[model samples]
Target: MGGVNCLRSLVVLAIVCLMTLFVAQRHKGLTFYKIDAPVLIAHGGGGLPEATTSNSLEALQRSKAVGFCLIEVDFDLSNDEVQLDRKMKDGSPILRDDLSNLTPMTLADLVAWMAKNPTIRIVTDTKDSNEKLIARLSQTGLKEQLIVQVYQADQYQIARNAGFDTIILTLYQSTMSDDEILEFAKANRPFAVTIPRKRATNGNLPERLHEEGVQVLINTINDVWEGKAFLKRGISGFYSDTLMPKGTSSC
Candidate 1:
């Protein structure tokens, strides 16, 4: 019985790897599974309940126990990229993604945490504008698990060239027109296009996304209705905060 079960598991694993590799050919070398289910992907370093732990093992374990294999997390860069989002004292963009200088954990800290939790997959956000740290992260052994999300097309291309893809390029708030969005997909085939749940109003985005050969994933939805609505809207996937555990009401 054990042998049979092991064989079955191996077959499934092989299939998953093949599918991942197939999708990854365009987005550098990282393969992503297009999970169509309404995903309760938690953010913060750790999973929920211990999300405040900031990438601690307890938070990861909680996410695991909650049956969340997919989630979002941040990787603080070593060097700060001074932009203009939240300017510093001098009115500069806060280059403070990782808090190695201000906060406790550094880049090394996040890498160490990733090593401890191998089962969890993450859509890694740069938080600021540091491609160097992202480049370094692409070289990790667990590189396949990381989805490099960049808003800038130039940065996206840079990361794509680095052999660490699984990417989701953030669309500017309500700026992507359907034709533009379709064009974007044609240019970046197979990689996911991340859209806000509220902005996924065009009933044709899903069809066009499929026709354009790009995956569709919505983000940051917290309400149960939103989750269900996105699923019904034909979104390829979505992120959530509730972190639904197994046997819990999907409601």
Candidate 2:
């Protein structure tokens, strides 16, 4: 009787240890590029309340000051395709969101600022060719700190060819079936996939992606509750135009 009880206890202990190890392995596998789950990416540098413009250096600074380490910035080529310019000031490239603004932050200005502040990571939303954008970022020596969001497979290939460590596929179109999406994800092995807030909230895509060890991030989530809800649904992160308050833990 006593021997039988001891054997049962040993068996239970072994099962518990195995379960713990499996959970740890699963958690480690879910991390993207060493960044843990529940990332908060500030969209366009988070210029809400009408104070600053999106993609402006002021907005980026504000987001950083509010404890957001990840910021998404838009990169667009000039009309002539000569260079990547968000806005222009006297025919020179600038970072201001408003085209009519004279006091615009140039790419050089942003690079200098980033040099001073090295903790911030950038998410590049390129409106030009991936090769061009990657070349531009590489010039600043910040390519390693970037998570490039690509809309097409060719763009993804270009970024991969450029040796980008982190790439995100922005799937805004519903033209592709779920199987197609999964197959593409398997083939490309992107760090994460960005989808619409509605789809992320209502579907099992997030779970399916998690099973495949891919992270799901929702875009343009302005409401704090909505962002929390998505996180509860096992979303890896969200892009938001308004920064969450200081000390908001993703865990």
Candidate 3:
């Protein structure tokens, strides 16, 4: 009976190994052009000294002058229009802040800006209105320039169907286990995965994703040395507020 039980265990282990191999082989999802895109994403348009306000036109201009082609912007629905809005630490809305006295920027305004700057690709970070934003941007013939970030797995298909070829499955809003996350990346094949800094450093998640040919991006990094540390660990890049490549400056 002991011999029989041992034989069963061996068979089970073999089956599991085969299953793992099968899954790894299927990780090649559709490759978008941005897979080998820039290594640094200007967080909230970057250039802190020049552009004190994030998600503003001035911030974007400063970021562009800093030689960044990739910029991450937060979105929110306001007055039945998409606006560049990110809440402050004290929970005050960016547009309504008495201090900044900034004007609200609508989607139409952004589209015009995008048309002028042909090389810049916008990475969206919309909390709940990604579907609306994707549809709206797609209609404007900017589908190729938009890298939509989806919070859920099903949203990936939705974004793809909306004419977006590049999609990023950000892990900040997901509750999936590490193994499950890896499986999702292998199966769906998003252009990249955005991970919180803490989670990126926790385990071999970044390495595993790289093995599957999925690029990994860490969020909200500011220091130059910290970004280098993550890059050393095989992290593809960072969503940084101020960090930029060497010899590139807002000045």
Highest-scoring model, lDDT: 3
User: Relative to the unseen true structure, what is the C-alpha lDDT of residue 45 in candidate 2, on a scale of 0 to 100?
Assistant: 62
What is the TM-score (0 to 1) of candidate 2? 0.73
Please write out the lDDT profile of model 3 over residues 42-69, one tens digit for every residue.
7765545524335877778767876778
User: Which sections of candidate 1 miss by over 4 Å?
Assistant: 1-40, 46-57, 78-104, 172-176, 202-204, 211-213, 245-251
lDDT (tens digit, per residue) of candidate 2 on 163-195: 787999887744566676788888878988888
Which runs in model 3 stand beyond 4 Å of their true positions?
A: 1-38, 50-53, 86-104, 247-251
Q: What is each predicted model's overall lDDT from 0 to 1?
A: 0.58, 0.70, 0.74
Question: Which lDDT tens digits does candidate 1 get at residues 1-251?
Answer: 99999999999999999999877763442111222364445555432331232444444555566566665665544336321122344532232354222233344544566677676666666555547756677667777767777665566677778887677766643365778777766887736887765566645676678665577777665555666666676666666554353354232
TM-score of 3: 0.76
**Model 2 stretches astray by more than 4 angstroms:** 1-37, 51-53, 80-85, 93-103, 173-175, 245-251
- Candidate 3 has an lDDT of 0.74
The TM-scores, one per candidate, come to: 0.63, 0.73, 0.76
Clash number by candidate, in order: 2, 0, 0
Model 1 lDDT at residue 15: 100
The lDDT, on a scale of 0 to 1, for candidate 2 is 0.70
Better model by TM-score: candidate 1 vs candidate 2: 2
Error of 1 at 133 (Å): 3.3
